[model samples]
Target: MSLIKKTFKTIDELKKHLKTHAPTFYYSSQTSTVIPYDKIADFFKNKEMTLGDLSQLPCSMELTPTQNLIVKGAISWKDAKDFLRSKKRNIMTSPTEELALISAGAATSATGERCFHFGNLRSQIISLTYLNFDGNEVKLNQDIALKNTSNEVKKYQKDYAQYDIFKNAPFPRLETQTDLMIGTEGQLGIITEIEIKTTDDFPVNHLFILLPKWEVDSKAHLEIINKVQKFRNMVILCELIDANSFEYLPKADRPNKEMDAIFFEIKTQSFNDFYEQFVLNLEYIDQDHVFELAATKFHNIRASIPRAVFEKNSQMGVVKKGTDVQVSVSQFETLLKIYQNFTKLGIKYNLFGHFGDAHLHFNFMPLPNQVELCHEQLELLYGHVLKLNASPFAEHGIGIIKQKYIPAFWNQNTFKVFKQLKDEHDPYKQFFPQGFMSLEDHS
Candidate 1:
């Protein structure tokens, strides 16, 4: 039996609670992005005295310390209001611990469209300049919008969740990184700043290499996957993000549809330099040629998909498609075999996800878009994952998105312990309440 059913609270009731007590602690942190990332930038900005619809929509609410943290320093009063129009884009969002403190303002049951609605007039971006004096330094921070319109994309073109880098000129070895950043689906979240290290500025070029999406009859590539492990030792901030909403991206918006891919990033002094090094160290050279090559081959391996493959995936958005849970990072290869088998059964999906860890992503066919049907599909999908010791809730936490998936990953005894913890924290059930259905609570 499901321990949690929707509270059936009207939107008005949710808004009133948000307006009055202001539950800024819980709702605001993780779920805010379940909102606007439209190409929309700002409303009105000026120093002259202005008047808002002050009668009912009074500015009666107060911003808590953390919510107000970047408001003042990151942007100006005018820009702050501009920032709020979206109230849902950027880097790390306002943590949840802050939102629960407020009465809880407007909450919704949806996901945000990341049309890349990020800008820095209200925000600023800077890079690390080491004293040891690196090579050419590229200092670029351009506005981030949904489509690749402006020329400043060089400033903001981030690699897909993962990439690689060779040490020097000869570039015998290679290093790469994967992504797993969290987003607040509905509550307000934005990233004001991010920092990375690079040697010199050069045109970042890429080869959109499309390989035959053939099934691996034998267990190969495990060696290259392991080689990446050693290279990861030199990685800085790498994470693997796996969300199911990727299947929802409109066909018109998705970049490359011909391939099941992975998102990864790499760095080099120049475009030519990167390609030369990448070719010389052919750790993954004949990867598509799977003839049982001893999995004990290379020392350093760099695996990745392409940027055109990545941008479209990001635009597809970040919410999960159904009530599927996340899995842990270990049981990946086993899960892939099951997923591949499902694919052969006409369960079409795009598999461009994080392979560095077990939190990989695959976009299923939206043939029957009904939530229940999708979830039924997920039940079977996650069943396979869990049967092999994988958890559906790997990177993303348990929210309404994965409420139906709690049992798939945890035993009843483990669920009981979580409920006890919830009782201790928000005894009044006033915080994030039932929205994310606590796995800790079996009651």
Candidate 2:
């Protein structure tokens, strides 16, 4: 978003205010965790002055906030393993293997990075698994996580919506960056901090709309997704919902009131009087209409017409494969139309994917009674995705789910590059022998 006005900074005043408030903490807390808020509190109590005296906080200024974790005491789940190792000082059972799997799996699912690498194992999951490290370690002035994390993530996720606009922009500019790591399949990471770059002026204001499920037709979806690239102040992230899966969500499994909601973080100028106008746009989409959505994590599969999600079973043997392809938006549009049209021909697809980047996440689960017909449908639908240049190995990596369908996206040249990289990094291929090492199938 472009800046409308100018913002001037006074570094001297910013430092003066900090010195008065935190003479000791201002120097010590820069690179350390577990900053005791009591130190700053004692300073504030002595100053007799309040926070409002300053014109504004500096752009690069940071605050240290800490919390007393109820679940694991002072230690957070992110570094829980460390606590487990130090039996005398800390208390807990080390679920090292489980932690690794969760962090590794999150990285694989979110960004499609192909390896369970060592760095990912320690850095990613170690931070995410810990309840205290995620928020309490930051040392906030108030007790936020004392309630819940989803609450904190959502509140901040919404606050930082405008930040993702600059996501494809600069690397060092992201202050609210969170890391996701997976070791053998585990989730690790936390909102380490939020940074607001030193721009002359902040983003202009704009309106954001949250569209409900039924309103997510092809025409509206494309319009919203395309607007991000077109309008500088517009932000959109549509979250698809599946009713067939929602009814099965246990009352406890569902997210907060804002769950299953898309965010349209707007940044524009002259928004002071446009609040009413923005509400009109949101009301048109029926944002107030709340519905129960289904998730693969807890949704029941037995009662659904065709089961989409399945448990990873030891009895299941997977076919190894590798593929990666990038498709143009126009070509992807054609492919989506074909798939959407086939839905009428008694063909069912478990579809829930990110349209913002033109990535499709689909699973075939034909009716239990129609075995022969189901096979034909899978071939036809899978083939269409391949022909469009859309990778079958999209967002979700080519895990045990669609390994056999690798050929649909990979050409001879692309396949060769993957094999070459595989050999370079993993000559022995011990970490994941089945992954991309399809010696028989590649031939």
Candidate 3:
């Protein structure tokens, strides 16, 4: 009866357990279907179905003397960071590390925007082990798989090269087969274990800048970002907060009326150089001498904005919907224009995020009755993003919620390739039955 205590070491055992106890369909009391366990039968017929409870798996880490870490997928980010810190090793911070810790067979920080601080989670992965739909385990490493999948890799690149959005955009290099899995969004397989490259622990310098709305126009912000790019190697984090976000902050901590803020974390060694080169007409409302505490405080503030929006909406019986959109650095001004247009329409929204990478999170808070209007606005906004050749789902993976928007990003041919990739790896759609492109869409 206790699912947490159950463990299935072999594929056959797992299959057998599931076939017997797992429900064919499990629905949430409120909205959508919660689980579709019956789909596994599509891949394996009459197998003894055993379901392994991954949550029961212990979190462990193996650290080499050199500081490289091999961590189990179920390990919490905070626990992993604490372990590394105990050994006097560096800890990389992914967005909301505690809440969005890496998932088994699932990738973290898949987008280029959030990874601006730390390298892409995929890039740091030296190797990984995953489970295919048939319950078979497959291990892959960066070097060997690259050579084996060279032709398919080339074709994948060539296909995307034809699209202006992907062709002109500054994409991170995909040097290995492991790299392709970074943004796969759990479609290919479930990642169980990961070997990651580590860095030498270094101190950081945190700085905060508050700019009045009039003074921090698109052109001025772009100029500041261009100057900051010179120290890209040293700059670990760069985030922008809009005026709407101040509602969550303390009255004393808030920026001036009609003003927004930018937070920066750079390696201490480059602090003086950054301070000297980065000249902007903004007020420094606060600066911290203690970098660690300052970075934590700023990160917490950034994390709280969403929760604040949700709580505020709940009290008013409204719902808040948010979208992540990213454009090439060249289209930063265009993206801002879209945001301004939305604001002019008198929509209640919050705009902020990693402007260094031209990724912004736009949240629309609408009453339950106004949900249709909010969605309509989102559709128009996405159309503009598409016109700019920007990605509507930038950092977040296109899970079930975003499935309806896929047609805008992919053509019939491109979508066909996506279906082929999914079918080849998971023909029965046993894993994450609703994520990425849906089975119904592929059919």
Best model per TM-score: 3
TM-score winner, 2 or 3: 3
**What 10-residue stretch in candidate 2 is worst by lDDT?**
25-34
TM per candidate comes to 0.44, 0.42, 0.78
Deviation (Å) of 71 in candidate 1: 7.5
- lDDT by residue for model 3 over 302-358, one digit each (tens)? 777755775676676544467677777777777777777766655677777776766
Off by over 4 Å in 1: 1-209, 214-224, 233-263, 269-330, 369-374, 411-413, 436-443
Q: Give the RMSD in angstroms, all C-alphas superposed, for model 1.
A: 17.5
Tell me the tens digit of each residue's lDDT in model 1 across 134-241.
112222222332333223222212211111110000000001110101111112211222231112122122222222342443132333334334333222112222
For residue 391, model 3's alpha carbon misses the true position, in angstroms, by 2.4
lDDT of 3 at 207: 71
